[model samples]
Target: MENQKKVFIIYHSGYGHTKVQAEAVLSGANSVDGVDAELIDAKEAAGNLDRIDQADAIIFGSPTYMGTISAEFKSFMDASSSKWMEQSWKNKIAGGFTNSSSQSGDKTGTLQALSVFAAQHGMIWVGLDLPPGNNSSQGSEENLNRMGASLGAMAQSLADQGPEITPPDADQKTAHYYGARVAQAALRWAA
Candidate 1:
């Protein structure tokens, strides 16, 4: 495993829903052979910036709050200014995911912010390759990528529900697929 590629998932979960999505992403990344994946909470990301710098891929996640990423996740982004100045993440593969209480919670805004952040660091942005699911007459809520997000994985949960019951299976699957895609891209990029 000495040559294994590392994938880091950095995220902030407001009500545990985003954390569930992050775990799904981790599971997907780890499913790839020779890939080692880990999750770092945004709250603790500042202390682990060096570890993230060494990763071949980095996936960001957060709960979409007020049409954007949570303030906590934004803080992590701000803390990485030093790395940005050094261009330490240049050429790294990057992806993003977000969750919110509404179906169309402007999750794209959060993903866009993440992609822009990666671009600022000179990292390559890996977007969801899945075609829009649940967009056809035959589509259903069980379809993956139901949110139809191409920028990144998107998940929606009910405000009244907890992470254990919300975000649904399809959204979880979409997050998983996106993670694997990023990991696979990282491997290819490194090669």
Candidate 2:
């Protein structure tokens, strides 16, 4: 539709685990009726910055490495300095997602970095609205928002497992829900 809002998911996945999460986020965003969602590999984003500029919302995804975003994704952030200088992304809806092998692999630090990156671009940050899950005595890894992240979606995968077998259904579902929320927010913000 002409009025459809665009959402770009820019991510860097080293071993495909984070790519799975990004795909889940894409699925959720595309599920919204008036949204057009697409994935942009962070490695290739520097050449497609204009496409990103046209987006109504942008969701960033990366694997948490050494307690923060991977160097490659950081490169994409640096490449956007031109946009930051021009405030081209100001007021655009923004959200983030990250994955790590350990459950508490300091993923919050990565989300904080993403948020800060968005802030530097003068973008509006959108956080996970779901209540913390798997925090109760009866809670299990099967709960959505299992990592209890509020800044963004978080997923954990076993170091030895592949994306097809790890990160679990709950994390994917949480990423999906987060994607939809961002899309909905974009629609409302544009309206």
Candidate 3:
């Protein structure tokens, strides 16, 4: 009987790269029918389990540093121990994203960390519907340059693009498409 799907994106951005991508992902998720999306700094999300408890689906994101989830995000994960113990997130939908300065910036490590946490919470995971390979420029647009974003919903932005630039149109579209897919899945399962 729920009328809407809520997606909570929890992310840690060390130098703003992941923050930008997280926003793009939110924009995408918000575009989906009957979906509401919001982004929370890792610290806040970790501290306020009530907000997290309200979400129908959760997306984790962070910049890959030393090939792993940033300490900020990891701290949030660690803080979720209470929810894990309570089985507060069991059966919820989960997804992840990351960014790095190198083309292969140990991004997968971040996703691995997230996946492990979700599994521990007994959550269901969602995969990127489109493959990174052979896209005919349906291409994730993340492929244009060489930065480390291959894991999860990875993306690249000029580290120095300043605040003037926004998530590129293609990337935003991809995010929206990803959002719609996940939203539909969340709705289906919730029903």
Candidate 4:
């Protein structure tokens, strides 16, 4: 019970594609030996701010639309006004993931926006430290952006047609990396 990692993932998926990536994150986090990762849909999260408050780290995910977090995720952030006022999310580790339609889709933009939001909330940010793009053999899909495009869990799903075309690999890797990174950060923070 002591020193177990506590991780929470809050996400919003419009067409259930992003949900695939979100679930992948949960899988990776749960695979970690000492981590407890939970997935909270934005709709469900709105009613249970405690879920966010109780974690050592929080990971946010969404389907990037118009180059940022979805309207649903924005609504969730807005609803967190109460927590923001109370500083409920402060001092915790934070991370993010997204799914869109292109290789350079608005997914990363969404992650950046979320990162800024976490900082504004007085939280620490954990980005993927894995080396993705440097290795030529790893290529695009095997690199962090290849097989694991998610050190921060930002993925792109093409079905939504945002330009992050054919992002299933990106989504899987993104989810995996985000989950592991969150768990790793939470464990350290909890220590």
> Candidate 1 vs candidate 2: which has greater lDDT?
2
Largest lDDT belongs to which candidate?
2
Residue 34 lDDT in candidate 1: 86
What is the per-residue lDDT of model 4 for residues 1-191, given as tens digits with 9 covering 90 to 100?
66777888899987777878888889888888888888899988988887778888888888888999899899888888889899988999998887777766756778888988898888999887765653476365545555244436656565645333345665576568668877887887878
Q: What TM-scores do the predictions have? A: 0.98, 0.99, 0.85, 0.86
Q: Mind giving the per-residue lDDT tens digits that candidate 3 earns over 1-191?
A: 25898889899987776787787778878877788889899999988997799888998888888998888888999899999999999999988877666656667777888888899999998867665642464544454222323335665455556433644554545555565666677878886
Question: What is the TM-score of candidate 2?
Answer: 0.99
Model 2 residue 117 CA deviation in Å: 0.4
Runs of candidate 2 with Cα error greater than 4 angstroms are none
Tell me the deviation in Å of residue 140 in model 1.
0.2
Per-residue error (Å), model 4, residue 104: 1.1
Give the candidates in order of lDDT, highest first: 2, 1, 4, 3
Q: Model 4's lDDT to the true fold?
A: 0.77
In model 4, which regions exceed 4 Å deviation? Answer: 134-140, 147-151, 160-167
User: On residues 1-191, what C-alpha lDDT tens digit does candidate 1 reach at each position?
Assistant: 97899999999997899999999999999999989999999979876788788899999999999999899999999999999999999999999999999989888999999999999999999989998989999999999999999999999999999999988999999999999999999999998
How many collisions between residues are there in candidate 1? 0
- Residue 140 lDDT, candidate 2, scale 0-100: 90
